[model samples]
Target: MISAGQASAWPKFAHILGHDEWIDMPEFQRVEDRVKNRVLLDPMIAEETSKFEKNVLLERLAEAKIAAAPVMTVADVANDPHFRDERSMYTEVTHPQLGPVRITNQAVKMSETNPYVRGCAPLLGEHNDEVYQSLGFTPEEISAWREKGVI
Candidate 1:
């Protein structure tokens, strides 16, 4: 989310970010050019982020008033009160093979219909007969294919 407007602030926080090369990087004329520079930027940012503990880096960013958020893991998201309790952004379901699994809920709410994950994803080829039948294939043909190992 860096922008041309943040150009001034970059130099101030460059020491905290562990890189002075940001000031030397070329000005980007287009989105593609900025994206192309990720080869140089990504490693630098990753290196800098690794030097500090997560909370320490976050505190530094907060002190600098940087608009940044931690990239949370699934367990972290599940435990966060805002996402789990307030927003109800996740739900748990029983996976046939994996047992209980926590899955994300629909972000968008609809007035007329309630969208939700009814079950875990189907196993491979679980709906083969139903799919082929809908496509005008008969039970006999589908069963024959299964018998002949064509499916």
Candidate 2:
């Protein structure tokens, strides 16, 4: 647990990393001692407490909202201006191996433009020659580096 005075200096301390300020902090000593004691005594209790809290929150939320709740259609969501105008929903990128990859604009929209991947994953060193050449390295230099296990 951090003290009030020490917690107040967190922003200032975070900015001065790799300097002597971190070594001079009073909170650092207290935190280190607390961690050491916890590691030595009842480590399982700390692990169980975290899992218990997560389960409790999830159980409460599940009870509040039915597991078989009605699903919303794309039409229902698209009526909202925020979902309709989102730029991420329509963005697409071209991969050298995969051709054009269609990125989903909306998670809920299941349509033709948002089809699953049509190409296989790229093989190892698929663009090694092209990339090295683009970086102004000659073919002979790339071959030498490859032989020496550098590339």
Candidate 3:
């Protein structure tokens, strides 16, 4: 990942970044232009990063002290012991119809209260009548909409 302050970090990436036109621009404008036009940077980073394993690149970035984070795959996050065991990032809950299912736990931990996923999400159109009635539609009108498949 490119640092926002590109000049200070240039020596490390100069070989890969090459002498691009933006290299000479002032720091603020360089950062602004990069953000506005990722076409200027993303391809280069992608090409360079592709040469290294993801974890190796992450380690190199950390060594350079450039703020970077990995875009984790589902399998990576699910299987990582730090997330699965230490932090309890995922947990199994009894889904009403599907039986036990694994789901993400809340990210925040608190001293006063514990929050969790209550249940599986409601089925499609599960609360149609209740929602329509609360919005002032009559039960008959809601049923008519359902029959017409307009819901």
What TM-score does model 1 achieve against the real structure?
Answer: 0.61
For residues 72-102, what per-residue lDDT tens digits would candidate 2 score against the true structure?
4777554545655653344456767677865
State the lDDT of candidate 1 residue by residue for 15-120, as single tens digits: 5676666666673323454467767666766787788888887777777777667888888988999988877788889988899998888877777997887888
Q: What is the lDDT of candidate 2?
A: 0.49
Off by over 4 Å in 3: 1-5, 15-38, 124-151
Task: Enumerate residue pairs that collide in model 1.
Answer: none
Against the unseen true structure, what C-alpha lDDT does each candidate score?
A: 0.73, 0.49, 0.71
TM-score of predicted structure 3: 0.63
Name the candidate that leads on lDDT.
Answer: 1
Better of 1 and 3 by TM-score: 3
C-alpha positional error of residue 55 in candidate 2 after TM-score superposition, expressed in Å: 22
Models 1 onward score TM values of 0.61, 0.27, 0.63
44: Cα error in model 2, Å: 23
